[model samples]
Target chain A: MEAKNSAKERMVQSALELFHQRGIRGASVDEILKRSRAGKGQFSHYFKNKDGLVLAVVDYLEAIIRSGQVDSNYSFSSWDDFEGWFGRYIGFQKEVDCELSCPLGTIGNDLTNDQDHLRRAVKSFFDWSTAQLARFFAERKAAGELVESADPDALADLCMVVMEGGMLMSKITRSTALFERAADQVLSYIRSLR
Target chain B: MEAKNSAKERMVQSALELFHQRGIRGASVDEILKRSRAGKGQFSHYFKNKDGLVLAVVDYLEAIIRSGQVDSNYSFSSWDDFEGWFGRYIGFQKEVDCELSCPLGTIGNDLTNDQDHLRRAVKSFFDWSTAQLARFFAERKAAGELVESADPDALADLCMVVMEGGMLMSKITRSTALFERAADQVLSYIRSLR
Candidate 1:
């Protein structure tokens, strides 16, 4: 039983990496199994199929966010953290050479309507991410740091849109020009609300 | 010669429809040919290969935008046109049932790094879209309708990001909730600038 769980964990991790690098559809099931070092029997016994594995991959991603490891690190507790978080995106595009996009977004965009279950899995990550940002705004408003009329949900959603959209542009252009400009404007706009 | 041109147009139009409905990779060459009712001779006689067809499709999509047949309808000459343009996105997500994303972005996201040429074709559309919006913002600043502090390029890119980002979320959640909130917030933010 322990070995079985280990194989499943390995498969999920491998899928996550491959999906990020090659896109969700670009990675085949056999390649995933090979990378996991797991046999066909083990995969069938564990995931049942590729869709099941994709769902697990998404769940793992959510765990990463919940752990407050990356963007969620800011928690929007302070303006400094907000700037730090947004700045990281600029650094991130350069680090990745503007080749990759948001893991969640890349998956979401790769999926089709027939892949509804997979799309929903991606949405869960977006929802969780937005909630973290919204909590910060709500807290700020409660403390009068933000204006009374400031819409936390809308603000949070805007932040997500800006980041996702900017990331998409960066990936397409192979340059962070659009993302850099977008980040500057969005940061200033958000600052004005305070 | 005219007959050959007719066949070429049919192939491109069919490719556009198929790519939009089934995704870039999902639509095979044979399927596109079958849908076009054109023979294999016509395929090679025109595009030469699938990548060629993809480039043509990207150009076709750009033409659609330039014709102001869709979102470019607003041209963003005035604030009312800006609001109308953004509003159309909300309506669009509903019309497509949040299943399809920005045609330009969908192609960009689906492409891998090796497909840089295709990515650039998609980028041209983005560049054009940004220029149209930037022109609007620039006009506003010149007319003293907007603050002197406003950066026209940044504002235009922000608009692109919001729309692209909102379309992505709508596609993921299979609902327009995130998009509606984002559009409302972004619209209000821009309004405050004037």
Candidate 2:
């Protein structure tokens, strides 16, 4: 059981990295297999095919967000906490030279129209992430850190859209200027509510 | 001359439609040939290859924007002008069931990282569009219709980011709700500036 789980984990990690560097279609099953050093049978055993592995990659990305690996030092108690989170998030983009986009988004955009299973997986990830953010806002509201006029669900949705959109633009322009501008505006909106 | 122009136009038009519906990788030269009813030699004569055709598609999309074919009925004189534009834009998304994203965005995102020539083409298109928008905002400010505190260039950048970002989210969630929300917030910010 331990060996099985390790092999599965290795495949998922390899898929995630390749998918980010080269897009979904650009990265092939063979490349993923070679990178993971798993046998051909191992890939089929772990994931039925490339599509199955792609779905696993989505879950892998979601886990990274939930684990706070990206923003390990930030909390969500106040507006400032959220600002800190954004700072680290965009800072990481700059650190990577703004070459890669949000992994879920890159994969989702490529597959959303044609792959129903993949689309559903991407939607669930967004729904789950948005709910997590909404809960944070709700908690802040309950703690009197946010204004009464702020709607947790709407704010959460707004943040998700801006971040996804900003990241898309950043990737195309090969610059973080648009991302930072959008982030600043969203941050300003949050500040107004406070 | 007219026959040659028409044939070339047919290829570009066919490519635009296929790329939007099926994505860059999903569409093939033969498929485009069949759709356009152009001879196989016609594609090569007009465009060296699929990559060359993709670049032509970018130019075709840019022309649609510049020609005002999409926004022919609307004008950009004041804040209301911008609102009307957004309403029509989002409404069109609903009309199309939100399946297609900005054509330039879709193509640009796919080719940005690996294809330097395509990336530059996409960037130039964005720069032109953003500059056009900035000019509109500048006109409003000069007319004393917008607040003096508003930066036309920054506001234009903000608008592009939100729209692009919002459209991306809408495409992923398969709904226009997020797109509308992001647009409304950006509009409100513009209104606040006024």
Candidate 3:
């Protein structure tokens, strides 16, 4: 049983890496199995197919992104906390030299219209993160930091937007200019509102 | 001569459509040829391989995006002009049901790390557009419409970031919520700088 679960985990890890390097459809089952060094029989028993493997990878990504907790540190109470949260990505982009986007984002963008289950899984992450951001904004509003007309939901959604968008552009440009600028502007823009 | 040029054009059009529908590697050369109904010989004569074909498609996308002109209307003289420019993307997402991203963006995201030529080509469009946006901000600053400390270059980069990011999130979620909110926030955020 231990060996079986390990085989499945290896497959998911390989799939996730491969999906990030290439795309979901761009990476084949054989390539993943080869990369994982897992037998064909094991793959069939563990994942059944590529779609099953992808679903497993999504779960894995969610776990890491949410830090393996139900309610993670998605909400920030202070400006410093928000900066810490936001700046981490800029640091990450520089670390990787903008070679890779967020694993979940790479998978999310690779999805086709027909991949209904995958879309829902991916959307769940964005929705959950955005909701957390909204909570942070709402806390500020309640404390009279934000103006009365500010919409927490929309502001949270915009943060997700620029962050995700900036990452994508950076990865494509192979430079952190877009992502860094977006981060700077968003932080100050929100602060200005306060 | 016209017949041969038309065949190549058809191939590019098919390639553009397929790349948008799937991804770069997801859409095979064979599939593009099949869709274009062109012979393999003609494909070889026009575009040596998938890379060559993708370059042609990039050129095609740029022509459309820049409207076949050298310096297109990438700059926005007025806020209404900016809104009109930004609003078109919202309408586009609705029209396409968020099934596809910008064809160039779709291609850009699908690229592997080794494809340098394609990456440069993709980067050029973004650079050009961002520069135009910076020009708009600079004009605003010159007119005393923007604050003295505002960085036109950074703000323009933010616009590109949000626009690209919003489209990506919108496409993934199959809802305009993220894009709409990002659009709203970016516009207002920039206006706050003025």
Candidate 4:
């Protein structure tokens, strides 16, 4: 029984890594099975198909991103903290050698051809992400941190774009610096919000 | 001879379509050849392999984007025109049904695994693009049209991100609204610079 659970967990973890690094279509079922050390029978038992595996991977990736469980003391008290957050985010990518694309953005790019269930998963994440940031901005603005004239939704949405775009460029150039510079600018904008 | 040239052109065009619609690795030679109505011999004559085809397609797509052409009109002369040009740029995508990803962004996303010439081609376009935009922003700032404090390099870089990010979101939601909103905010920032 324990081995069966491990098989499913291994498949999800392997799919997350492979899909981010190799891409949805680039990573084949054999690679997943081989990497997970699970046979085809095990894979079939867990996932209906590649799409099913992809959906599970997306969920796995999203949970990691949203956990945001940095030390309670590690809070955004000032623009410096905000900027530092962006820096650390970029720093983490560099530390890993950028083998992972934002799971949502990577899948989002590949799913352009077919508007299947996979596409919905990507959209929901962006939508929820946009809203969450907007809420943060709204709170900050009410607290007199952000300029009231600033549209929380617009600013939050734009910040998301900058991060993704920076990610796209960083991945292409294999230079984590591209992300750091852009994130710095985003931090500046957030600071200049008055 | 005309038929032969046309067939090659079709193959390149179709391959670009499929590459963006599907992906670099996701797309197969058979799919491209079939779409182009060309035989294996004809394809081999034009391209050594998939990489050769990608290089040609990258050049083709880049030409189309560049041909949209930069406006000589400065931000100082007419902020409205600047805004309009930016709007038209974002608006054009909506009319196309979110079928095309930004060439640089799309290629960047796919190039993660392509280690040879294809990756270099994509990186070159992005570097050149960022430089050109930075020059434009600097020129505008010199003319007193843009805020002196605004970093041309950073702003140009942000524009790249904003556009790429907007494209990603637009494709995911199957809606043009996000692109339009993001573009509007940029235009607003540009106008504010004036």
Candidate 5:
């Protein structure tokens, strides 16, 4: 059982890495298999096909995004933390080499005409992101730091849109400068509410 | 000469429609030739290959974006006009059924590992977009309608990011409603500034 779980975990990690580097359609089963160091038999045993693997990867990504990141723990507690957290997030991407694309943004763009399951997976990820942001704003209001009319849900949605777009531009331009600038603006706007 | 120009224009229009529907890499030369109704020889005569065709399409898209849609003919003289113009610009994709994909966004996310020329083409399109938005904001500021402290360049960058991400979500969820909601938030923010 432990071995099986380990193999599955390895497959998910390999898929995430490959999917980030090469797009959903571009990353092949052989590549995933090779990266995971699993044989064809092992791969086939785990996943029905490429689509199944994609499903697994989507779930894995969504889990990580929804599990923490923007939860009450590391997000929107104060203006400084809000800006600092996001700044560090963007900065972390630059530090790691700008080649690491935003997995959700990249996949979300490519999976538009794809299968329904893929579409749902991407949507769920964004929905969760928006929800988390809304919670952050709600907390700010509860703390009396935000105006009653601030509209946390809407603001969160707007912030997500800019973030996704900024990351998309950064990936395309190979420049973190634009992302950093945009993130700064967002953080500033958030700070203004206080 | 007129006939040749019309044919080329049709080819470009057809390519944009098809490319948005079926991605640049996913769509084939044969598909483009079929959609454009141009002969094999004619396509080759016009472009070196698929990459060349993409370049033509990008140029065409850039010209269309910079033309009447922007420029001085439209008055962003008031907050309403500013929000309305920007909203319409981003939201028109729903009408054409190209809701989720920015031709440049799609290409940028897909071609992260592409060669220099392709990357440069994507960068140029975004640079033009950023510059145009900045110009619009500059005009708004010049009229003294915008906040003096407002950074036109930063706002433009943020607008670009939000619209791109909004499109991604709208496409992923297979719902045009996401863009409207996201745009409403943006429009509200613009209004709040005034």
Candidate 6:
């Protein structure tokens, strides 16, 4: 059982890295298996195919987001908290030389319209992340940290849109200027609500 | 010459359609040839290869934007103009059932990180689009329709970010709600500038 789980983990990890670097179709099943050092049978045993592996990658990414691996220390307790979180995120983008695309965004964009299963997985991940942020804002509102007029759900959705958009533009431009503009605008909107 | 141009056009049209439907890597060269009804040799005759074909598609999309084929009537002359343009855009989204991802955005996202030629092509499309909008905003500011504090370039960047971001979210959720939120915020920001 232990060996099985580790092999599965290895495949998922390898798939995630290759997919990020080469995109979904660019990364092949054979390459993933070779990189993971897992036998060919292990891949078939763990995943139905490349598409199935992609779904697993989505779930893995969701787990990472949920576990706070992206930004473990930040809490949405105050305005400062939000700024700190965004600052770190932008800083991390710089740390990686702006080559890092959002794992979810990259996967989501690479999927074809016929890829209903993968699309749903990506959608669920975004919905889950958005809902988590919404809940945080709702809590802040309940505690009077946010203004009465601020709709937590709407705000959360806006933040996600801007962040994703910003990331896409940043990746294309190879500069963080677009993202900073987006972050500034979102921060101002949040501040206005306060 | 006419026959050659038409054949080239057919291939570009077919490639654009297939790439949008199946993604870049998902669309095969043989499929593009079959759909275009062009001789297999025509592809090499017109384009160096699939990557060259993708560059042509980028140029085609850029031409569409430049020609104002997407939304030609509404000029960004005032706040109401912005709203009208966005309204038509959202209406088009509904007309297409929200499956119409930004052609440039979709292709740009699917490219591998190492695809410098394709990446540069996508970046040029974005820069051209942003510059066109920036010129519009500059006109508005010159005509006193927008506030003096408004920077046309920055405003244009924000609009593009929100728009591409909104399209992505809308595509994922399979709902127009996220797009509406993004459009609303962007409109509000533009309005505030006036």
The TM-score values for the models, in the order shown, are: 0.93, 0.92, 0.94, 0.89, 0.87, 0.91
* DockQ of model 4, rounded to 2 decimals: 0.57
Predicted candidate 5 versus true structure: per-residue lDDT over A56-174, tens digit per residue: 98888877755674322334566666656556557756865666567876766666454777878878877777787788888889899887767787777767776776677777778
Q: What tens-digit string does per-residue lDDT give for candidate 4 at A1-194?
A: 46665988898988877778867887889998899899999899988888888888877766666675432112344555555655665765787676455667888788745557888887787787777767777878988887767887877766777767767777777777666666666666666676
**Taking chain A by itself, what TM-score does each prediction score?**
0.90, 0.89, 0.91, 0.86, 0.88, 0.89
Query: What is candidate 2's TM-score against the reference?
Result: 0.92
The lDDT for every candidate, in the order shown, is: 0.82, 0.78, 0.82, 0.72, 0.71, 0.78
The full ranking of all candidates by lDDT, starting with the best, is: 3, 1, 2, 6, 4, 5
Q: Give the clashing residue pairs of candidate 6, or none.
A: none
lDDT of 4 by residue, B1-194 (tens): 56755877998889887887777876899999998899999888978887888889988776766665433222323445545644554565676676666655675687655464677788787777677677877878888777777888887777767767777677777776767766666666655666
lDDT of 3 at B140: 88
Most accurate candidate by DockQ: 3
State which candidate, 2 or 5, has the greater DockQ.
Answer: 2
Per-residue lDDT of candidate 1, residues A8-125 (tens digit): 8999989998887767777898999999898999888978688888888988888877787765354666878877776788788899898888888877777867788888778877
Per-prediction backbone clash count: 0, 1, 1, 0, 2, 0
Every model's TM-score on chain B: 0.92, 0.91, 0.92, 0.83, 0.83, 0.88
> Local error of candidate 3 at A125, Å?
1.1
Between candidates 3 and 5, the one scoring higher on DockQ is 3
Model 1, position B86: C-alpha lDDT score: 70
- DockQ score of each predicted structure, in the order shown: 0.68, 0.62, 0.79, 0.57, 0.58, 0.60
- Which residue runs does candidate 6 get wrong by more than 4 Å? A1-5, A72-75, A143-148, B1-5, B72-75, B142-149
Q: Scored by Cα lDDT, where does model 3 land?
A: 0.82
Ranking by DockQ, best first?
Answer: 3, 1, 2, 6, 5, 4
Model number with the top TM-score:
3
Poorest 10 consecutive residues of model 4 chain B by lDDT?
B69-78
Candidate 5 off by > 4 Å: A4-7, A69-76, A112-114, B2-11, B69-78, B96-99, B176-178
- Per-residue lDDT tens digits of candidate 3, residues B1-194? 46655989999999999998787877888888899899899899998788999999998888777783422256577878877666777777888898876666778888887898998999898898898888988998999999998989988888888888877887888888778887888888888878
